[model samples]
Target: MEIGNLNDYFKFFVALVAVVNPVGAIPVFINLTANQGIKARNATASIAALSVGIILMVVLFTGEAILRFFGISVGSFRVGGGILILLMAIAMLNAKMSNIRQTKEEELDSTERDSVAVVPLATPLLAGPGAISAVILHAQRHDSTLHYLYLSLAVVALTAITGLLLFLAPLISQWLGKTGINIVTRLMGLVMAAMGVEFIAHGLKQLFPILGAS
Candidate 1:
């Protein structure tokens, strides 16, 4: 909590950023909102960003309660989340995981017009199961309320920044070019995969007493 000890908070911020990878998500955002008008696209981005912030806050505050309600331990959630992240990393590495086509199908419905941000963007794309699980695990790790608040704020700020960058994704995509984007995506996938392995290892260590003892 002291000024000198803020390093931990900063470290947490970096970890959250790496896990969320807002910059890495920009291309997907561009692809998803390609069909919408400028105004609609901007609105969707704003809503999606706000939705992600809200979802993170919920996980930070009530994540334990939610997990308890479901009779799921934090270790269990991490193991599951680790697997999900691994799958996502594979998709990122392969570059064929965009849900734009599926989103387009859903958008074809009249009632789906207002749900764009909440549906594909906010849910699976931005604050999907992997993100939710990550935040919940983070909350469980941080016992201090102040640290939790700081970490949550950092996550929200990072998410908002990512969303803002995503709103200008056309320019970013042009600047990055296909090759640059592919390189960045591959790098992010590698990092994500490593994180997934760490999560799995942590969960297994917790679940297996012998592993923890050794």
Candidate 2:
């Protein structure tokens, strides 16, 4: 509603984008769909995008309740999630996929599948723990109904953009080339690293108000 709120939401959106880093996943999408025709690749992209959005939205809404069941404190979860995100950020900085999301074996296995829309693409790549945790942390921190609605919209917007990128994977690949993609990935990596540090700092502040005040 206000400019500050809009800016906050924009940061939230950026955190989602950075953690998911769809641009970084483009090469993987291309490799996975290399065997398919253009139509099939587009189909896979659509499904993966929709699935990822739905999964993350569910987590965003229900994450706190799930944590309660598991007896995990928000601050504790924030610290852990920050670590996970930081690890992925480091991996991205190196221009490689994070092993936390997928292993080399999993990537190899995707090649043997008929469709990878839900496998490595949607789960490990898009809606992996890092992304899910980030959304959950954001949701938990901002629990207003208005924020919840905005979060859902943000997820949809992100997924749509990611799908568009995947749909144009070929053209994007040709345009960006390997070096360009790596450059973009590294930039996003820097953003992710900053977000990760912020998450950890917030969590620590919550746990230690004295340090936060200082």
Candidate 3:
């Protein structure tokens, strides 16, 4: 078996980390499962992570094909997707949920449901448009089977990390406190903004090859 490339894996992790921002989701996770017992909370965390991992894995492998079916070019996708990620980053920095990722409707809906792991937690919160775009972009950049496997591994690893954090949500909240979480959120936002800019730059280079020559 081919060894996984650290550099590629790092890139995947960075992009995924910035987009997923599992740390940023702690408050919401805590709120969503506030009434649940420890076992229920742990189960919720696992399901959310598993669901998100599945969503990302599917997109990572099939996003290119989906774009092709829609006749969307990588350059176009990068520019558009970058914009989405940038907006999310801005919201993250502001310590608010982006409407694009999670809306008031979803929040309200979550309160009514006994199980929110698959809906708001996994679907939009963890694997929403921002995360989806980042994964597709990652797939576009690293296409080899080995690299793809690495990408898949990164998704699993990140999701597992996310789950662990959620499982320990109460402790994390207590240790980090609200102020600490906000600080970390902003820092992650900065990293995400950087990723967005890189995406736009790369896409522009493709859309206008002349720029690369100059």
Question: Could you give candidate 1's per-residue lDDT for residues 1-214 as a string of tens digits?
Answer: 4222467567556555655666666766776676889998888888888888887788888988998999998788888878877777777677544442234455355234545676666766667776777777767776776767677777777777867876887888889887777777777777777777878889888878699887
TM-score for each candidate, following the candidate numbering? 0.83, 0.96, 0.95
lDDT of 3 by residue, 1-214 (tens): 4544698679769779878988889999999988999999999999999999999999998999999999999999999998998998899889878899888987898899988999989989989999999999878875678878888889989988988888888999999999999998898888889889888988999999998899
The 0-to-1 C-alpha lDDT of every candidate, in the order given, reads 0.72, 0.88, 0.89
Q: Compare the candidates by TM-score and give the number of the best one.
A: 2
lDDT of 2 by residue, 1-214 (tens): 3122877778989889988888888999998898898889899999999999989988987899999999998888888989899999999899988899899888789899998999889998889999999899888866677888888889999999989998988899999999999999998889889988988989888888898789
lDDT of 2 at 182: 94
Kindly report which residue stretches of model 3 are placed more than 4 angstroms away from their true locations once superposed.
1-5
Model 2 lDDT-worst window of ten: 1-10
Ranking by TM-score: 2, 3, 1
- TM-score of candidate 3 against the unseen true structure: 0.95
The C-alpha local distance difference test score for the whole of candidate 3 amounts to 0.89
Error of 2 at 213 (Å): 2.9
